[model samples]
Target: MTSIVTIARLGAQADGIADAPGGQIFVPFTLPGERVNVAVSGKKADIVALLDPSPLRVTPPCRHFGDCGGCSIQHLEQQAYRDWKRQNLIDALRARGIEIEVDALVECPPHSRRRAALTARKTEKGLLLGFNAALSHRIVDLEECPVMLPSIVEQLDMLRGLGLLVAQTKEPFRMAVTQSASGLDVATDDSGALEGPARQAAVEYCIANGIARLSVDGEIIVEPKKPVIMIDGVAVIPPPGAFLQAVENAEHVMAKLVVEHLRKAKRVADLFSGIGTFALRLARQSEVHAAEGDAPALAALDRGFRYGDGLKRVTIEKRDLFRRPLTYKELDLKFDGLVFDPPRAGAEDQARQIARSTVQRVAAVSCNPITLARDLSILIEGGYVLKRVVPVDQFLWSSHLETVALLEKPKKRR
Candidate 1:
């Protein structure tokens, strides 16, 4: 069915929304108050014609803006985009019956994304490597990516050539590329088994092309140079496909908040501490015990701490927090400060334990607002007062939002 409709507002996913005869319809690449003739089907609308354009819409920077899944809110005006992001945090917290003043969205500039996970496949026609298209599995073969660092974008062709040489099947695979102090750290997965000659060619490609390191299926094929990332002042060699803050600016901003919040404490417990992003910095002042499930990530953190100079005692533990959250007794034993940066699901089970702990101060970092809200509500019920909440736009021009929340549990007087 084709009909014209006026977009009322933007939804949580950065798509323009309309209240139709059905429940609701989502139309991508369209802004609020734009009357667009769309092909409607099953609560989704594809804009056939722009009958009216919204004043808030602006010219997008990237040529592949609409086709690429990398960004969604790039067309929206700057101030509007910031408000919409901050409002997302507010709304999420409100849904959990918790109300607080959310700080303004901290903006990140374009061309600063230091990490990217791209799709790749060797096709009969040619090589296809780039981000997946919006709402589809097709790869948008990118000529230029405005959101990623030029360091990564400049080597796309070289990367595709390597992909073609190592590809074992026609089906798609994944390539995770991270920019480090030395050079690019490339990891390929689901590309099938690379036999003897093919693996040799991929290794030669990395060495000849000045690529720092290349790993296939979690195995390092060639490491012409060690891939190192300097966090605060310590250097770390991240494991294959390790988690990193997408943008450098956002990582520094979030780190500053976390470090300052727990600065006064003598002992700190960092749960889900990946690669010691915060623990290494925190160790400059406090005795830190970092726990995580990924053994490789924990090993990297331990190495960074052991080699870092002018730092306090920092210990690493490999523990699956989702399965066994640290109990309140364990936390209260020696730690006065706590920090946990969990995945998108948030740390519900761990938050329950923190609620019962006597850890004086805490810094909660999350990429999902709804899950963060749920955890914060849990901490509040356990007598923790939410002191500050700062929303960071780590994933720029996308639906995702990152938040740094500070909370303090009061001391019992004798």
Candidate 2:
């Protein structure tokens, strides 16, 4: 049934929420204070007509904005869009009962995302490669993507050809492509099992197209050139399908915040350090001990540290922090500064351990504000003061955000 409802606000998922007699209804692609006629079905609604448009609503740049699942909130005006994202962080912190002044949102420009995991499938007519539809498994073929680097988007046909060559099963698979210094590094996961002929075709395709590296299900198929990502003048070769910051500019912003905050410390420990994005930069001044669960990533960090010139002492440890977070007893007040950049789940166990320690300075980098706030709350409860929080818009037009939070513990009383 079609119903007209006034949008109350944008929810956590960037969907317009409307209060009705039954319950709250979520309408996608609508804005607050706007009246929209939607076809309702069990708390989910599709916009049948836009009755009253919001002043903050702007025409989305991409033609595939609503169809493609890669971006959200592209319709919001620039200033309003930024404020909405910044408010997301504030709301999350407030939910945790921790109130503090959040720094302004750092906006990453369009066509800045260097890494993307796109879905691919072989239809009866031809090969389909692009992001999946929002809340659906169906793939939306991309004519143009405003969020991804043009270099990556320009090679869509090439990627599709490669996908057609590698994909063996009828089901959909994932192709994770990253724009490295060498070239585009393509890695496939959940693709059909690679038989002998399929593997041979994949190798030939990578060599013929000059792909930097091609890996199938974490196994390297062929590497024309080592995929190297330069971090602050240091070149590091990450493992196949390794973790990397989505936006280069945002990475620099976060690193600068971390390095400046820990400038005075003589020694620092980097937890969950992936390929030493911060460790190598920090080693320029302070002695850095980088620990991470991925052995290959740690090895890569150590290699970069060893080869790089004019850096302080840098060490590495391959330890699973989730299983055995560096304990307070283990920490033993050894380091004055610490920097941790964990995954989306947000290092809860590690945060608890860090809270009980005597670390004077800390820089917490997270992609999820809710978990970041939760971790910050734990630190604050343990006597650490929340110094500053900066929301970074790395994944532009999407609900995802990155934050760099600096915290400090006061000196002990005599």
Candidate 3:
């Protein structure tokens, strides 16, 4: 039965929050302050039919709206979406007892920055080729994706063809597409666990269709392997499946911020320094020790540093910061600064250790703001003062917020 409901507020997932007679219901595709007749679907009532739409709800730029799971806020105007993201970050931090003045949200140029993406496998009907449907495992056939870089969008047809071939073979596959200024890289997985003959066929199709630089199961199958992307005019070849920041331009901004923050210090320790993005750049101005858990990424960073001229000031260390905290004896030499970029979980033990360390300045880059706020509180309670919190909107149209914070130890009392 279809029910008429009034949306109350916006939820974290960009769904409209509405109060039902039973309880609070989240309706997708319905904006706040809108009265709509919706048919419920699944456990949490989804808006099946919108009898009335909100004025704030505008036509999404992408034709794949309401289907593609990648973007939820496309129905909102661009400026409004940006404003909402900024407020979401502020509110999230406030809920954690941290106050932030989000005066200027760093804007990301649409369709300009994404470097790596994973597309979904196509079904037997040969329609969907991008991402799974919203809140469902069924793939949504995509004709176009507005958020992707222009180059990637152009290759959609080829990708669809590959997906169809894979589907016919009854093999599951995951396609990793990475693009840079130099060219595109298409990686296929034919391991039978994911995608088998279909993946192999995809690579063959790419080669036959003039797609260069392909990798299957982390090994290059075609073209001499090289970094297809350059950062600040410096070519950086990331290790296979190594963690590179998915957004290209945002990475540049993040690296610049971290490097600028570390420039004032004489010695710095970069934790979780994937491919030495921050460590290498900061080494130009100061000595840096790049510590990472992944050996392959660390090896690639070391190799890159060997050929680079400006980053001679950097050193490399392979350590899992999560498994064990850095002890005083381990860091016998006091560092002037510490730059850490941990995964989504944030650096809890590492942050605690830094709070106790002799480092005067700390720069923390986090992919999750909630964890960032919690970790920041720990540092604050540990005698460190929060100077500034800069929020970077790396993942647009999504609730995810990336932030960089600068912290300093309090001056000792006389």
lDDT of each model, Cα atoms only? Answer: 0.93, 0.93, 0.73
Worst 10 residues of 1 by lDDT: 15-24
Task: Rank all candidate structures by their TM-score, best first, as comma-separated numbers.
Answer: 1, 2, 3
Q: List the residue pairs that clash in candidate 1.
A: none
lDDT of 3: 0.73
* Error in Å for residue 156 of model 1: 0.9
Instruction: Write candidate 2's Cα lDDT for 1-414 as tens digits.
Output: 999999999987799999999999999999999999999999999999999999999999999999899997899999988999999999999999988999999999999999999999998887899999999999999878999999999999999999998898889999999999999899999887787988899889888988999988988889999999998899998888899999999999999999999999999999999999999999998999899999989999988888898999998889999898998766646788999999989989999999999999999999999899999999999889999999999989988999999999998999
Winning model by TM-score? 1
Error of 3 at 113 (Å): 3.5
Whole-structure CA lDDT of model 1: 0.93
TM-score of every candidate relative to the true structure: 0.99, 0.98, 0.89
**Regions of candidate 3 where Cα sits further than 4 Å from its true position:** 41-43, 122-128, 161-171, 190-212, 328-332
lDDT of 1 by residue, 184-287 (tens): 99999999898799989898888999888888899988899989999889999999889999999999999999999999999999999999999999999999
Arrange candidates, best lDDT first. Answer: 1, 2, 3
| CA RMSD, predictions in order | 0.9, 1.1, 3.0
lDDT measured at residue 126 in model 2 versus the true structure, 0 to 100: 75
